[model samples]
Target: MFRILIVEDDEVITKALCKQIETWGYIGKGIHDFNHVLDEFNEFDPHLVLMDITLPFYNGYYWCTEIRKTSKVPLIFISSASDNMNIIMAMNMGGDDFVAKPFDLNVLIAKVQALLRRTYDFSTVQNNLEVHGAVLNLNDTTLNYENQKIDLTKNEVRILSTLMENSNRFVSRDEMMQALWETDEFIDDNTLTVNVARLRKKLEEAGLENFIITKKGIGYRIAE
Candidate 1:
């Protein structure tokens, strides 16, 4: 289930939003310590964030900017300040959408649903392996990671996708070879090792170091 972080200080509003989030079949968490908002955000690792403009210590904009530094998770601004300036500022501060306060919960839920569907539905509807902030678009055999992109050969894509799909589990050499051979001629054992080594180097260059780990004589695993 997708997890959302609520950064509203109002106890009543926080509780109500959490209940609404649960009813909509999403996980929700509210921040209790305004001073350590970023810490709470990292710990939660939420898929989305709902933040208030005016806050006790640093305000929503500050926290939103902080989240942008490490992740591309969607952020939505919720506040009583509905002025154009606030909305514009929210977008400028890395918020994906804005929800004005004193609003209908159903309407808010609708917005949330649309955002979630737009962001996540397309992937689930199509079975794709995603990892380390990168998406392996199975339809095209392309790897999209943030702003950079790479096209993969059929076998290379299958190998990486399988390892990524079963991340943290050792993918035996035999299993990998079987997957590779599905589309083309049998790949020699050394060929698989070479491909994996190259893939690991590429991932490391893309800032995903230790993405794949070797088990010496056994197999390879996507490192946890």
Candidate 2:
């Protein structure tokens, strides 16, 4: 089932929207902590986002811009401010659609279904891995940080994918080598070390110093 995230602050509206969304067989999640919108977004990894223009801490446009830095997921703006300016701003800020408040819940559901079909029907959905403020784009094998994009080689992509997929814990060298070996590459201890070293250098150049931590003989993990 597709996952949708609701970024509205009003408890009643969020609850209603989530209940309606789940009825349509889509998983819906709401943000409880306004200050950690992006963190919640990363954790939920929603396929689509329902954003409100008037949110606490930061507005929807700001969060939209931030999310566009890492994802191309379909975003729809739902707000009381449905003026021409707000609609235009929403589109310019990377929103795929806009739903004004006081709208019929059925109409909103239809719009949501239409957008989801239009977006997912024609393209494959890719999820990005985010650590700190840097985002790794699995679709293109590039890292985005501080508004800079760094391209990665195939080996680097494999190494980073492995480490980032297991960001919660240490990934042993043998496991990493196996990940690389699946690509039919000649991967051994020395090759893994060189690839990791190169990946680290690239990360450091992008201002992510010590992004990967080594635990002596245990394994590697993304810095906490």
Q: Pick the candidate with the highest TM-score.
A: 1
Candidate 2 ranges beyond 4 A from true positions: 123-224
> Against the hidden reference, what TM-scores do the models get?
0.59, 0.57
Q: Ten consecutive residues with minimal summed lDDT in candidate 2?
A: 118-127
Question: How well does candidate 1 match the true structure in TM-score terms?
Answer: 0.59
Cα lDDT for residue 152, candidate 1: 67
lDDT (10s digit) by residue, model 2, range 77-142:
999999999999998998989999977888999988987775554235445888788888765668
Q: Per-residue lDDT of 122-209 in model 1, one digit per residue for the tens?
A: 4575657777778888655567787877766656787887888788689999999988876434598988888887777777777777
Q: How accurate locally, in lDDT, is each candidate? A: 0.82, 0.88
Best by lDDT: 2
| Models, CA RMSD each | 12.9, 13.3
